[model samples]
Target: MSCVFLALKIGKVNWQPKLNKAAHHTSDYCSTEVILRRGQPFNISLNLKTTTQSWDNFTFIASTGPSPAESQQTKAIFSLSEEGASGWSATQEPSEPRCLSFTILSPADAVIGRYKLQLQVLAGNKSSSKVLGQFVLLFNPWCPGMF
Candidate 1:
């Protein structure tokens, strides 16, 4: 199941939001925020002000809990590849120019709570990060092995 989440555009913004409730099993949510399940994959799209270069590096950070410390398992740092040290991962999906899409997956044992998502971009020697948004992650009741 893959749900769509649109983050901020770098410069002037153009919002075109589309949330797939059926894919994320979030049809029952009453709030405006995104709701996801552990051990599942979701989709996110971003529109950048400038075209991305081959040297550009993107990293995602998802943090939950009050302290949100990495050692406490309340935070996860992942990238465009699934081989990250963090259990969470994001893979690039085919997208249009200056527009990027990703399929993100959280670990099955991730802490269940509200999470703040941030995107960090490393371009050459300079690095900047932006807070994309927040979302709620719940235990996967549908997963047969997720007891």
Candidate 2:
């Protein structure tokens, strides 16, 4: 059996949603990657700064494969922040960094080879993407104790 892991980080501490003429806004988003040993658990942290009472609807997508165009063997999406507004909504202030993490269950018959993991961030309908932040996996079939 083999395992996978992922980690994430944004480039800046202060981020504001870009507003359109009607004042509709969309925040900037980013992603990171992590590698893990088979059967191990992993964690990821997300940080943001905003004046809104609360940031809501932040989204994340996770996929595994050799490339983006190829089929992903596994995938998932979830929210990164809670709802409600903070007291600093009227001023420019940095919010505390938050972390979101999940575990991967390696396939019972995982093959020994290089695999790819991709993470994408979506704000409303817009999409921002990132690749592996960690090293690639190398599976060895010739190790001792192998049949």
Candidate 3:
């Protein structure tokens, strides 16, 4: 008798959402710290790769405020737009490299803190949350004034 064990595939996280690769920066516990300036346009591409099955529906949600993982007090910042970036949100993204560019417009009154990022991939009834942990949303105010 031969044993046949079919291995399953998982999704991969590509590109830094915060768009910075700082050394020894382990705040979110996954990728590097993401620096988001206040009232700035955060346009980033969320590149993903599926190994096994095709995606039927995909959704990406970000945090509006800083919160710990598995906490029920997480606020939804915004959903990733399906505009451009290979149109991964409109169709079942194949097993190739899927690209979904998300533009997070940081409100002027937005809180500056570490926010978590969650990606939901669904194939029929089965779904998975590829939580990339938290990234630092920095709000720096530097003005050239007299010291």
Candidate 4:
């Protein structure tokens, strides 16, 4: 399931952040921040530096909302690594950045908010494309609003 959410607006109301576990293939994965009334849950991670090519097949799909031509209900839930031959690689040369971490789930009622975290990177075809970056989901308004 591909679901990325981070909405904050305090003073009015609008907060959404939930993505409890991520990191399947390789690159990098870290996104955790789901604390409505406790603590711990705020670590969004995703790093990539591609240029390597040749390709037998290397897939990395991650989506939440928007993009994908502008959302069609948004769907990007992919996790595959451990195929074979060092996770399959052809070699175009240009590797040095790879990280992915995700963990977010704030549900207790959640209210006092502000968020908008989006990340994308799908290189399955199309001669290989890239666009990995997106962030925004702050918390700490005295923290304590799960309702």
Question: Which 10-residue window of candidate 4 scores lowest in summed lDDT?
Answer: 1-10
Candidate 3 per-residue lDDT over residues 1-147, each given as its tens digit: 011101122344444443433321323545435655544444444444432333335565556544433244345523344433321122222233445444544444445577666666655456556675555665445311212
Put down candidate 4 lDDT per residue, 1-147, tens digits, no spaces.
111111111121112233322211211334343323212243444343322222333333423444442134233333333322221111122323343443333322222233333333333333333333333223334334422
Give the winner by TM-score: 1
Per-model C-alpha lDDT, please?
0.73, 0.31, 0.44, 0.30
State residue 52's C-alpha deviation in candidate 1, in Å: 2.6
Stretches off by above 4 angstroms in model 4 are 1-38, 51-97, 100-111, 117-147
User: Which one wins by lDDT: 1 or 4?
Assistant: 1
Q: TM-scores of the models, in the given order? A: 0.81, 0.35, 0.47, 0.19
Instruction: Give the poorly placed runs of model 2, Cα more than 4 Å off.
Output: 1-9, 12-35, 46-96, 138-147
Report the Cα lDDT for residue 139, model 2. Answer: 34
Overall local distance difference test of candidate 3:
0.44
**What is the alpha-carbon lDDT for the whole of candidate 4?**
0.30
Q: How far is 144's C-alpha from truth in model 3 (Å)?
A: 18
> What is the lDDT ranking, best to worst?
1, 3, 2, 4
Error of 1 at 32 (Å): 0.5
Which consecutive 10 residues in model 1 have the weakest lDDT in total?
1-10
Instruction: Write the number of the candidate with greater TM-score, choosing between 2 and 4.
Output: 2
Relative to the unseen true structure, what is the C-alpha lDDT of residue 87 in candidate 3, on a scale of 0 to 100?
15
Model 1's alpha-carbon lDDT is 0.73
